[model samples]
Target: MELLYNNSTNYFPIYYVKGKVINANIQTYGGSEKMTYGIGLGYYNEKGIFRGTGYNRVDLNSTMNVTPVNRLNVDLRLNASLSNRDRTSGDGTLQSASPVETVPGDPQELSSLLPGEGSVAWNAVLDALKGTKEKNRGVRLRTNFRLGYEPIDGLNISTSLAADYSIDRRNYFQPSYMSDDDYSKSVGETGINLMVLNENLVSYNRTFKEEHMVNFVAGFSYQYDQTEYNGGSAQNAPSDKIYYAPAGMPDLGIQESNGTKETIALKHYQSDMQEKTLLSYFARLEYGFRDKYLVSFSLRRDGSSTFGEDNRWGTFPSVAAGWTFSEESFVKDNLSWLSFGKIRASWGRSGMHFSQNYLALGIMNVGATPYRGQATIEPEWVRGLYNHDLSWEETDQYDFGLDLDLFNHRLGITLDYYYRYTDKLLTTIWLPGIHNGYSSQWRNAGAISNEGIEVMIKYDIFNREDLYWKISVNGARNWNRFEKSYDGKDFGGNIIGKPLNGIYALKTDGFINEQDEMKVFYNQQGVSNYLSNFYKGAFYKPGDYKFVDVNGDGTIGSGDAVYCGSALPIVSGGIVNEFRWKNFDLNMLMAYSLGRHIVNNLSKAVLTNGKYALMTDLNAISFWEKPGDHPDYPKLESDRMNSMWSYVDRDVEKVNYLKLKTLTVGYSFPKKWSRKAGIDELRVFVSGENLFTWTNYSGLDPETVDITSGFDLMSNYPLARKYTLGLTLKF
Candidate 1:
């Protein structure tokens, strides 16, 4: 039997006060000769840093084993859970009015401002916490059963069946005070999903002459999944109190406006259903000689309903081999200190079928529209252009690795190098302007390649009875590129020969300092000609940014923009250390990343002099103010269009950081003391996460920024420091 409890709290700066978490679990197990059983129950709750946003869940799990016959065995497992999540934190209505837009003022004064109408940041926070509400509640259930029988030595057969089902309901409401139209609204949604799987396997294991061994296994599996969704929204609710129920709203009759009358339905509804299935057959064989040489091979064929009939099935195969040279007589006798050494290699091919259901066939939507002043049902245009030639996306990968252990296993090291290539990438292509009433078509378009090397090392410094210490370090470096495309077109920051998701921007040479300097530069660099050709001959001010002319044509154009950086990290790694003395133990973890860049969009927004508050930092003061004033940013002016400043090198920053990810210390009570209290063992621990960070990036928490777009637009939540205390008990 065992029991556990944990509690933690998160603290942030001015925007958030504190968030709390609570967790508890209980488990017990007992077994006899013929049967064994185990069961567990767990509960979790959290209060988010943002008001009116939190999550709660409860789950139960159980497993049982039975052996009714001499060579037959049966196993059963079941799991069930209920969870609820609050989504008010993601409300776009409040997000659009970000606190950063509020004018600078005292905290107490801001809080006293009028709700919904005030320009104070505190008002938006209050409205988000009280005026709007959204929540999703879900229930999930899963069960599995397996049976195995061994009729003869070195032979076994097994079959298993599993099923999962879940249901979810969401409710959202916004009062009239929170909307621009001064009308209360509500929305209701419900969804259900079900899946089932069945599998059967056969295997035989035997050793030949005690030095050579062979094993073989084969299996067949089938899976099916179905999902159904229905949702509706209603406006003009009677009152804010009538939430989560669309029926509370009433339809409004036709009314004359500008000599026109139109009927309006208070509620609008929509529904969707999707289903998919997969079937597969797989087999694998393994062989070994004297435990020093090993080889294995596997193959599988899978068929999916998401693909077209011509490409419904795909075949994948893999092979691996390993050799332990340390087991040879030469190493055993000559290199006695080398306890272990192995070299391994493998290669594999895989397929992906992730498109939406029924994408290979045309689809039509039905809706209601006004016809001759009367409501009529009509068929809308096709959802998307369909093509029956679509096939599965495939990836081929190869790996080679070496493992070594020295000093009686006190030091260990592992190194690996791998290359992966993917073709027939599943993506959407935009058609030429509303072709056949459709804007886009799904297609397999391009090829990409990735090559990387990873290394890991671990060492034991002290292995004494009372004191033990170990340290491990691991790191990886990868390079990714777009190898080929159908039309030789560049999109989404991917270039033909450059790294994927590269950042392209114009180079700048600080701000224009003086009018005389600008005049002399324009004459020599042809800035006047370039502006006239590209920017309608917009005149540049002394405080404006001066772009570089890379082509020496004396004008800056779109072609002058060059590749600056990439969104993907070139190197990333982590380090872990563990130590124990007597009954006390300690662990520390650190993580780092390099060669990634981010565009500080938040800085651009604040410096644009729009309807946003200014940042109270030294960077904000570095804007050019007058002639002869050299500055890092352009002059704070909103009257003219500054297109050159939109994408410039000034906004891109290299984000290299080393963070102390976690640290923990714990002590275990002596067994005698625990036994006196009717307990088998007990332990207590304290841990801290995100405690320290070292970085040159200007953004708040570089690790939390968006990796895909590499833009820090202030939409992501900042990482919070956390402290946790926990206890474990067993009997």
Candidate 2:
């Protein structure tokens, strides 16, 4: 397609060190420039569903590191990914026209009103319309090891190992451009948090002398993961243009000669998605005194090949205690300026191994049918019964802490407060079946409690050197509840443990004016959260926005979209400074967040109104040609575009932000001009990243979407870059 989207050089990117061992000059070569466009519409009005996918993978990870012994380590990574996907998902056309599994870029023609009945109204058309203009190449190889020993003296030991290998490929453009039907890949993994680890544990510190001072540990961890998707599929058809495939599919008598199925292996139907192996046996015990009250206990045991029966075994435990109010001696003689303070508490139980393999049980599906005509029995996509209690996914924690270091440390603090309860919760839920066809499975539900508060503050204002000032401020606040219910259903709304890879959309309250239009309220499922009746097809109203109808039931729907704020940044933190004169160095970073939110669908599709194509050459003319001289956006040409939630009013604010992410200026040319350029070190750097943002956030780039998933990705990718020019030589 325009010569592989403008080819620049022979595709290359392969690096693997463990599994199949392959590395070719650790590659890299430039090529990436994008420009995309989108417009969408799909029907459904009687019972529905919609789908989506938008792509952008701008990758460049270059790695190189090697350290031998004293705990060996090695790493080699290469990634040159450019996946500019533009997806305008589809769905919403059903109702008496089943068999709608139309794939290949779905939307198989069906709009003469109601194409129903085995739907030839193009029955979910999409006569195979899948698009993926890819250029993927990934490589990785890693190795790490650790070892330590102390034969006697109280005995000690240590061990660790980590290995990883990866290879990824993509160049499957089918229809044309050029292809030998290519794709080759491989993967391998080996992890071992090995630890025969031991510490000052001298026989329980000689029988807990004077209360305590003991240590003991045990270890063994093994992990093995494998992956092999091996790609290749083709047998003609791009208007029969080439790229092999004369025979393969339904074999055209081995089509003119070019045909290879070489034993078809898409991991042989995803052989249980391969990769399996896990072994664990961990232990720990620590007692204390003289170091001022402390107690620790730990236990862990696990074994898995993806679980089955007795859940493949699992047991985790923990207990902790520490108290050293400045080592208590009358508070260490009146808090000698509080040199150090500690207060800790713990209670734990953890387990969770992302089980996947008969997810606790159930499998069987085979196909090949002809019936009475000789071949038969058909069914697919299996796996639904293998529960030996299907195992792990437990978290029970309760910890309270406070560790402080005042004066002498120039101010340091850590205050933690926790209350975790995860109970069962490995959900697959729903079970109330009818002939065992599907109700819900994958048990262990209810119980979700996450209470939190963490604060980390450290300030040095000056740490020596020519000049250095560091200020770290951590913040956390979590609140969640589900307490109990798998189906016991007293009420199940959904607000379980909020932050974890944030982004939980639909909250925007500014639009609607006319002296507030009497609070707008629209129910009967159009929701506006109570006030009543009114809602005559509102286009926008009110001093523009503010909503909170949590459950007075007046209606604002999605149960009023709770969990109000956070697309990440409920107070994020960072501030650093270093200034030196000798070799001239200046680095600065200031990051902040006081609340988070973002939707600005390009400012709601150019301030709502429509008629702008936006192909982005930025200014190739027409801002709406004579549009009240730009009345704060809302001036489109009218070709029918406007609809970015047209004048939002979802109620969820506080995107409060403050940033200066990074700024740097450096100089280091003298050292006799770096030992006469024989290079050991050379520096030249001018940097600026995300330079500035005050945030009232109208948005063109507020870190492009993903405020935590509700799928509102209006085509993203390309907001990362505020600048960098470089040079660094070290050989």
Candidate 3:
């Protein structure tokens, strides 16, 4: 006997002001002979975007199995969760006292004679939900247990234990009449995190009767983690209905304004704790014959506590092989319509411990000075500078593969080639703040190398029973460099053989027309020494910008930077298509990226000459006025200070795009109307995510990176184009 069941539910909504979402899931299971059970439930709720963004979650899980004899077996699992989240911390209060162009540059314009104070773009999401409010509450627990033994037949042995716990609490309130400003505040936080895991296992399998086959496994693992944090904050609160006690506000007296007397700052709080551990040992081996030969081997040995105990352990290894030339009989006697093929190779080693300071190998921190003058806070070993060879961070990988199934199986292909090779490489080094006042030091020098190539293809192109079509394509290219660096120069601008997130600038050669304005004021070495040399003389002229001294050293700072591109993506891809008739179905996905480079920085903050150029909203692209008319920007300067080679090579660009990313249409409900509504299955779908894009990168998104200067694009957040309608039911 056998039985199984599953259920799902979802409701999604979007249209601003706390868009909504609700999801549900359920599972059920069945078994035969000596007990087996399962249960799962999940629910999620979301109402986000403005007004204290949202989240609500709940989950419960259970599993059980028992055999009790005849080679023993027992397993148990449980998980529980509860959550409530909402965090929005103010910022965004709509300000504009000038430069306003609230739409209208064409299409039967309506004039306002432009002056200012007319902006409205959802007033920055309703002034960021008026005056802050944050909340977070969470509780979670997890459990697992397992035991197994095979006193005979093929061998098996196991042992496991797992535990997890979580607790979070946060509360914040801002009200100073919601900062129309007079100052009022409150904050509170509580966090607790813990985890534990243990495992032991042994396994063996054999089959020497069908042309040799063997399997083996071994394992041992242990992990532990802990975190605790407590917080408190209070500021000038006399009422907003109290409650933010760090000894009840109001203290450190002295106040009188408008005639001077000031001094009033009292209440504050903080707390923290951390812990970490890890230990591991593992092994694996497998072999096979006549099944067209295959081999595997693996090994692992960890031991961490965030390194430094003289390089706290690490040892990883891997090996693999496969060959199945369609079970070769010379490819089934001369490739008669070949239907299968395989080739494989692999090599590996890995380690990287994320780094979360378990003292980072040395201690003493606390900092903040003043003492003899009363502003206390001490304990400092002068900030980080100990290295017991910090360790952990070793990559090393290689892979080669091929898989194919032609015609007889309706065409399919896959090919891959890879190489990794990481090496010490765990950021932050530089310590030498004039004798180690600590400015870096997180050791593990450098070395990086990544290589890639991948391809996948699938086809059906209409194989019908009632019409069916399918298509798929995949692509990859990748290539990274920087294969050594203990200094070899430049890290934060990423130099040394480039591509560690590349993109260094300075190298423009345009603008500056007016027939080169006397060869740029005679290479600007003078012009009568130009207004005392501001940016190497009289701050440019004749339509501005013209760089590229590139160590030819006619001037152009930072030793004329270089490597101006690549923020990943040296090829990337996707393409999928599917169509079906009968009950209707259609799908399309399409994504692409090539070479990669962006950084329009919102058009150098509104069309060149920097910092919100004429104050705001500009960029109709084409400057430089007259002098044989050419124009491609450069010449519109208002309070110009720009000149990092004038907006990093005129704002990068070329982020080769091609997105469609998703489009789906589906319908299914006809199984005689789902058996008169007793519904065994039902479906309805309409989806569009991103939907369209083809880029020349003027930046608003060529997939805008820059979440804090990862590759510098600036004017972040702007990539939302979605529409979804879905319904699916099964019982």
Candidate 4:
């Protein structure tokens, strides 16, 4: 057995709060129960988890909303955090000493005017630490911050700013590194240990709404981020403790010594200063005639930093008209079942920025520029390659909705349907040309449409004998399409049939049936089963799982791939049922999604837990015990690889199932009992999540989906089930 790290430790205080001033002193320590990486910075790379952030600091927040002035609102917020963390570097690299060096950026950009002087060394940092442990000393700080704002309604003006001055040495790890990824352990020490950050954001919000309901807003801001990377490891202690400096002391003068060092990805530290401003003019007008009909029109023009020279500004406008049918003279009192009804419709156009700083303007990457002497890479897109010019991808949507309330508002229902078509899509794909380095330039080469229908219904079930019951259900169905594309224009291919955005791999069929059945089977590549088996001259065998070939070509191939039909239940929604009796209450919320399938991509990994790091704890190996065990899962070395179907052929299934999302049971003590307890009201609740699952999926919970992995159909992160018991009191 190989050991990634074996250790024992104690660390120091990098953070302590003395009144409002928090001081920094770093000392961190720990050993790996399982292999883990040594991060030199506060990395946010989340691997198998939501974010790559290492054990993150627990945050504490409190807010105070105070009315200092009659018409003004003042709000103050304070935040604190306590986190336990440790980081390690490789062994004794500091022995072969290197003198400190300097860089040119400030902690808060406050040093921007001065030629920045920074230091990095094999020994300089080692002297500042105590402990033979391979400690990164980035021990987290207990930080505190305050934000205050005062706002006056009609005047529409407020200033909001945030400061996160951590006593923790400032270093930003790229997002991908701090992820909860399973692979994080193996590559933990791959990046430089660095620190540098004192950032701030301050902004003002101002809006003007007129008597006619015309409203508008405008703003500007700047952001500066700075970092300094110190990749040195320590001495003495252990070989894995790179920052510990082999001698365990900084001033020991162990220079010119030789030792091992685990190389981490030296973070390419670079500072970015972006001065951003948003200029906009907007107006909205609302009019109602005799309170029976209403009309609204609004327009906004915005200029931003992300656009190219010509497309720096985009203008959006919307118009809506509604009719309140119940307000009519003849309809006001005729119907009791229909208390009120409003029919409304609207059309609007919105623009989305591509976000690249120079997306709109042509740019040249100049290398080592002395103006004329600089090497520059020119923009490749020949100007005017397309008939149209640049503009933000535009989405034009039209909506129709009906809002109704019946029987004194006891039964209420709302139905809305919308269709949005987005054109000038700003995305890039490989054009069919090797001349342009295997690709062509970026362009608005296609269009897509998103249309959906939504319905919400609520009813107050009858109440009797001091008990009340209510039920409500809401759901929506949507269809998305790639409306047009240049490639489809010249070919017979169904551009409209572009496969659904993310389809579970092809559904799987059980073991091959009769010999004749095996003959028709095909791999995703469209290779014929008959031809394949004939050449091998094999017949269908029992308990040998099989996959059906959608294409008669008899192979599971890209050619046989088709758009997924009704995936991940196009119709997804939840139902809430509530009942109240005396002083007790019960509520059940059940939600479901059908038509979506999970490829069980991790099947191979899990099946072979015999080899991988995470799967080491699995017990399902050697699945079939004896002759008639007739296990459906195969235990083959080849099956674990690209065999069953490359990452694409899929052994997918229709992930259609219903589940209860949340159920809560609570009890409220009688008012007299609350008074005895000196509380106005008291309640307690018990809740269990993912209490049950009814599905054929063998992997894990069906509710959670992994965002990162897909190419090979591996199982995503397994969602955890939780149970909570809580209490509340009101005075």
- Taken over the whole model, the C-alpha lDDT of each candidate is 0.76, 0.50, 0.69, 0.49
List RMSD in Å for every model shown.
7.1, 32.1, 31.5, 14.8
Give the runs in model 4 whose Cα sits over 4 Å from its true position: 1-277, 289-291, 355-390, 431-440, 462-466, 486-499, 502-556, 564-566, 602-644, 647-650, 676-678, 706-715
lDDT of 1 by residue, 582-617 (tens): 999999999999989888765565445321122324
Backbone collisions counted per model: 1, 37, 0, 72
Q: Candidate 4 on 47-71: residue-level lDDT in tens?
A: 1121111233444444445544454
In model 2, which range of ten residues has the least summed lDDT? 10-19
Cα displacement (Å) at residue 240, model 4:
4.6
TM per candidate comes to 0.89, 0.26, 0.28, 0.61
Which residue ranges in model 2 land beyond 4 Å of their true spot? 1-210, 213-284, 295-297, 308-325, 328-331, 336-340, 343-351, 355-401, 404-453, 456-566, 572-593, 600-628, 631-707, 710-731
Give the per-residue lDDT digits (tens) of candidate 2, residues 563-682. 544455555666666566667787887766666665444334323322112322223323322412322322243322212233233423356666787888988777677877687677
**Model 1 worst lDDT window (10 residues):** 2-11
Pairs of residues clashing in candidate 3? none
